[model samples]
Each structure stands twice: as structure tokens, then as C-alpha cells.
Target: MTLAVCGAVSACADTSNTPASQRGFFGGIGAAVSGSDERRAAGLEQSATDAERKKQQLEARLGAANADAARTQVQVQAAEQRLAAVRSDLQRQKERLAALRAGSPSGSSAEEAARLQKELDALERERRAAQDASTAVTTATLRNLEERTRAIGVALDRLGAV
Candidate 1:
């Protein structure tokens, strides 16, 4: 009977087996770990999303600045071309006026004097308008460049790049 009892007790002490109830605790720990890992993953994903949004906004502003620069260049070129044409026209007008003054009497007739004066005044006005246009184009370009430079500088400062 003692020998039989010893064999039965050895059989009950199986080294490779665990109770089923303790498995629940390990499962709960695994679930908690998974939940914490999911929270960390979500946080990382949100950070990446925010970074991407900022990059897109910067790109959009940069593109707008480049486009504005191109438009300003075109406008400045057009203004320059118009100024050249106006200069040529002014030269011809001056020559005509000089010829008219030369041919007229020393004490000119009232009507002749008035007509000549009117022509001169019209030419002067047109020249001034052309000059004004040229100045405006130059000023506009400079201001636009300055604004863009300042904006970029501020952005760089925010990024600690400057």
C-alpha cells in the first residue's frame, strides 16, 4: 500500500502542467500592455499628422510667394517697355515743338502761341504719367520683395534656423 501511494503521489506532481485559473492574470496583463501600446501609437500618429499639416501650409505660402514674384516681374517688365515707348514719343514731340517755335514770329500770334502751348502741355502730361507708372512699378516690386523676405525670416526664426 505504501509503494502504491508513492507512485500515485508522483503521478499527481506533474512538472509540465499549470492550473487554468492563473492564465487569466497573464491575459489581463497582456491586454493592459496592448492598451498602453495603442495609446503610444496614437500619440505618435497625431504628431506625424500635425507635422505634415504644417509642412503643407509652408509649401502653400512659398508657392504663393513665388507666383507673386513672377507676376511682379511681368508687371515691371511691361512698365519698363512702356517707359521706353513714352521716351521715344517725347523725343519726337520735343523736336516738333522746337520746329514750331523756330518757324513762328518773335512775337507770336495769340492763336499760334496758344496751340503750340497746348501741344507742349499735352506732351508734358503724358511724359509725367509714364514716369509715374515707372516709379509705381519699381516701388511695388521692392515692397513685395521686402514683405516676402520678412515673412520667411520670421518663419526661420520660429524654426530656430536663424
Candidate 2:
């Protein structure tokens, strides 16, 4: 009887140091046979979770960054178009000035010639002012777009998803 009792006790005894609660959870391994294995498993699981969460966050931020980049691109294109228009207007003014110079009356009164010359100078000055204003606006618009693009790129870098 004593031999039978000892056999049963030895058979029921737990050999490994792993805790019972950390084992047989839904009949699957929770902890591990070795303590280091348990710790490594925990670290790996945590790292995987952290990586997944970061990926989701980066995806959300990327959408916003892409939208900002698109908006900036549109602004840049519009600024370029306005600049082109201003340049075209300047070209037209040059053509008009050339035509005026070529068709001046040969023998107008001295006073009349002086008045025509003054009119031409005033028109040229006005056209130049308009051209300058357009250029300034276009430059400002392009700068704004460039700043926005830089902000988007910074965001992308910060996310580290790129």
C-alpha cells in the first residue's frame, strides 16, 4: 500500500518550474518549458503588436499627407499658370510698343509729338506696374505651395512609414 501511494504521488508531482496558471490555457502553451522562452515569446508578441499599431497610425497620417501634397501641387500649378499669363501680357505690350514706334507720324507738331511721347511713356509705366504686381503674386503663391509641400514631407519622415 505504501509503494502504491508513493507511485501515485510521484506520478502526480509537477517537475517543471513553470506555473500551472501559465500552462494549459485552452489546452495551448501559455508560458514555455524554459523561463527564457517565455520572456522571448512575450517580447516578440509585444513587438509585433507595437509594429502593427504603428503601421495603422502611419497609414492614417499618410492619407492626410497625400491630401496636403495634392493641394499644394494644385496651388503650384495655378501659380505657374498666372505667371505664364502675366508673361504673355508683357509680350503683348512689347509688340504694341514696337508697333507704336514703327508708325509714329513723320512730321507732327512739336507739341503733339511731345504729348504722344508722354502718353506712350505713361502707358509703358502702367503696363510695367501691372506686370510687377502679377509677378509678386505669383511668387508668393509658389512660395506658399513650396512651404506646404515641405510640411507634408516632414510629416512623412516623422511617421517613418516612407
Candidate 3:
């Protein structure tokens, strides 16, 4: 009887010909659990790869922007320098006109004063044009740079959150 009982137990335990699910209640649980874990791991890996690609793209854009900003800065500086030179020339013309008017009250002196006054007027116009150009360069370039920088900052922030 003991031998018969042992045979019955061995038969029940022998699962070589049984499908995994038919072997027992927990027979296929490992495969199911491991499959889900593998899928989750693959999903996480994909997300990481996407994030890294985005970061590299953003960095490239930032490098280009920085180079553009540097160029714009140089342009602004040149514009400012030109404006300053125009202003200096205008001041000198004004002083010369004042001196000519103050020197002699004769007819020839009056003619010379008028000529200087015309020259001064032309210089004033030149100064105004230079100032306007400088202002335009500063406004447009700086505003564009500011917008680009803000966009980059936002992108970086989003990447960090991810």
C-alpha cells in the first residue's frame, strides 16, 4: 500500500508532459510576471533614449544661439561706437559755429556764420540718423536674443523634469 501511495504521489508530481499552466496554480506565474517586467524595462529604456536625443538637440540649438548672440553683441557695440563718433562731431561743429558767431559782427563774418550754421545742421541730422540706427540695432537684436534664451531655458526645465 505504501508503495502504491508513493507511485500515486510521483505521478502527480511528474509534470514533464504537462503544459506549464496545467502543471499547477503557480506554474506559469513566473513567465507572466517576467514578461510584464521585461516590457516595463523596455518602455523605460525607450523613454531614456528619447530624452537623451531631445537633450542633444536642445544643446545644439543653444550652441548656435550663443554664437548668434555673440555676433549680435559685436554689431551693437559697433553701432554704439558709430553713434558716439557722430555725437562728438556734432558737438565740435556746434562749438565752431558759436565761435564764428561771436568773433566779428561784420558782413563777411555773417556770411561765414551762416555757412557754419548750415554745416552744423547737416551734422545734427547725421547724428540723429546714427542714434536711430544704434537704437534699432540694440532693440531688435537684444529682443530676439532674449526670446531665444527664454525658450531654451524652458526646454531645459522640461528635460530636467522628465
**Which tens-of-lDDT digit does each residue in 13-53 have in candidate 3?**
54434455564543334334335345656877999999999
lDDT of each: 0.54, 0.51, 0.58
Best of the two (1, 2) by lDDT: 1
The C-alpha TM-scores of every prediction are 0.52, 0.42, 0.50
Q: Compared with the true structure, what per-residue lDDT tens digits does model 1 show for residues 1-162? A: 965654554444432233333435444344343354456568779999999999999999999999999988888787777556555654554565455555553443435545545654664565566566663656554344334434433432332321
Winning candidate number (TM-score): 1
The prediction achieving the highest lDDT against the true structure is: 3
Steric overlap count per candidate: 0, 0, 0
Residue pairs of candidate 2 with colliding backbone atoms:
none
> In model 3, what lDDT does residue 132 have?
71
Candidate 2 per-residue lDDT, tens place, 37-90, comes to 466568779999999999999999999999989977886566657555544544
Which sections of candidate 1 miss by over 4 Å? 1-34, 105-162
Question: After superposition, which runs of candidate 2 have C-alpha atoms over 4 Å from their true positions?
Answer: 1-41, 105-138, 141-162
